[model samples]
Target: MKVVAADSSSAILNEKFDPLTIVATAAVLVDSPYREARGSLPEPIYADANKGYEVIVHEAELCLNLLEKTKADVVHLDISLGAISLEELSPIQFTNMKISTLGKQHLLKILPRIRKIAGEITRKYGIEVLAIGKESIPVRIAELTSGANAILYACEKTLKENQPVLLGLPSKCQPRISDESAYLYSLMAAEHDVRGFAADQSGVLEKVHISEVLNPIARGFRALRIEPKT
Candidate 1:
């Protein structure tokens, strides 16, 4: 008897949106404090983490619930390890985890298992489910910087699958500098996608960098159109 309230601020409520617009949610282990209910919201919300691998199944179900409620075109999730530890660590420890290759690899290993949940949900709902690690870009720490590249990769993968899933990205990409923590890549990858540069090799539509694909600025692009490639 869990009830998830719809917040008006949710992007899914937008009347006009990009065809690739996706809903994003985070998947964490059960008993995670980061799952705290917002604004006295009801208990048993999907944000509540489930322990162990059960989290994958639980989050997949939650995604479906969200889809049913919002009729969202796509749903994507940010999967993470150390669900409990993520919130318990000190700032330095938390900061270190963002750049730790071993930490990311450990989390990446869990994605395949979770992708199975996406497959299951796809069959049942006829919708696409996309997943990416929170620290999807291994080379950069997203703590105070941007993760445009990782977002682009996930978006490309989602388009290839013809599934709707949230494309996780930093609101803004920061400039690269001498600070060791800064992301080395430029923000063009994300900006390019927003500008509507896309590619279709056979039939699947993939987002292309501004430089990678011809700019669609002439006619303008708003949504992705699925059509057969001739």
Candidate 2:
């Protein structure tokens, strides 16, 4: 089945390697073989890290935006609520879930907006939007896709601001640059071929130098230090 999914990844890190802002969000369409994105829509948000929950609304909107370009059997959201129908999700229904109080409150605040978008997607395209989260391979692809695009965005930021950016990648993923594109490949077992890539049409990769480093605070997560080439 063709699946569309959305996720945000990477971050602008502080001196202490704590994330300050989320760098990019992506929506991808994946078909059978389920290895990589067939098509994708990516956006650079640079949103505050403390307000990370707010990015989901943008992710949903990106999925909707992507649906305009291609057809899909379903849309998967990174909400992680048992693959429930996002269009029908109600605040009353959240009370019984095992989520923490803060997370529940955050979802409650965004439910109306998210449901509105999900309803539109369902009504316009006759496909359901599921809150399947990370368990769905498509969502994992979206995360990698977003992380790949985040590398380009970080390079642009570093060049424009004349400073450096520390980017925290998605868990257990590594980056590879080929031709004019940057790609993030899943390192998790059984996902050997699952990967995502972003084109560097503007040649951002040439303008910056990137170094990989292990995240000191977050195990299993890697980071990139991007700086303008001197």
Candidate 3:
């Protein structure tokens, strides 16, 4: 089945590698044998990292926006709530679920907005938006897609501000630059062919120097040091 999924990934990091802002959010359409995105819509939000839960709203909105341009059998969200139908999800449903206190509170705050968009997708397209989260391969693709695009956005930021920017990439992914595009390939086993890429049509990759380093405190996660070419 064709799947559309959305995720926000990558973040601007402080000197201690703490994330300061989320760098990009993306929605992607994936077909069978889904190892990569067939089509994608990516946006650079640069939103506060402490309010990460709010990004879910933007992710759902991105899924709806992508639906306007293409069709999918289902939509997957990064909510991780047992793949429940988001349209039918209610705040009361949280009582039975085994989620942390903070997680439940965050979901409660965003439920109205997410439910509104979920209802719209169902009524307008007759497809269910599942809170499948990371279990869905399509959602992973969306994460990598957003991470790849985040690199471009980070480079642009460094150049615009003429300073170095520390970027934390999604976990278990390695980045490569080729053909004027930046790609983040999933390093997880059995996902050798799965990758997400963003084109650098403005030649931004050439205008910056990027160095990859392992995040000291976050195992399996990597960071990039981006500096404008002098």
Best by TM-score: 3
Identify the runs in model 2 with alpha carbons over 4 angstroms from their true place.
Answer: none
TM-score, every prediction: 0.26, 0.98, 0.98
lDDT of each: 0.31, 0.94, 0.95
Give the worst 10-residue stretch by lDDT in candidate 2.
Answer: 87-96
The clash count for each model shown is 5, 0, 0
TM-score of 1: 0.26
lDDT of 1 by residue, 50-162 (tens): 22233344455555555454433333344443333211223334355554665454445555555565566566656555443343321112211112222333334555665
Of candidates 3 and 2, the better by lDDT: 3
State how far residue 159 of model 1 sits from its true place (Å): 47
Q: Against the correct fold, how does model 3 do in TM-score? A: 0.98
RMSD of each: 18.3, 0.9, 0.8
Give the worst 10-residue stretch by lDDT in candidate 1: 5-14
User: Candidate 3: worst 10 consecutive residues by lDDT?
Assistant: 173-182
Model 1, runs deviating above 4 Å: 1-57, 68-70, 80-99, 132-230
The residue pairs in collision within model 1 are 30-49, 30-50, 74-164, 75-165, 76-166
Rank candidates, TM-score, best first.
Answer: 3, 2, 1
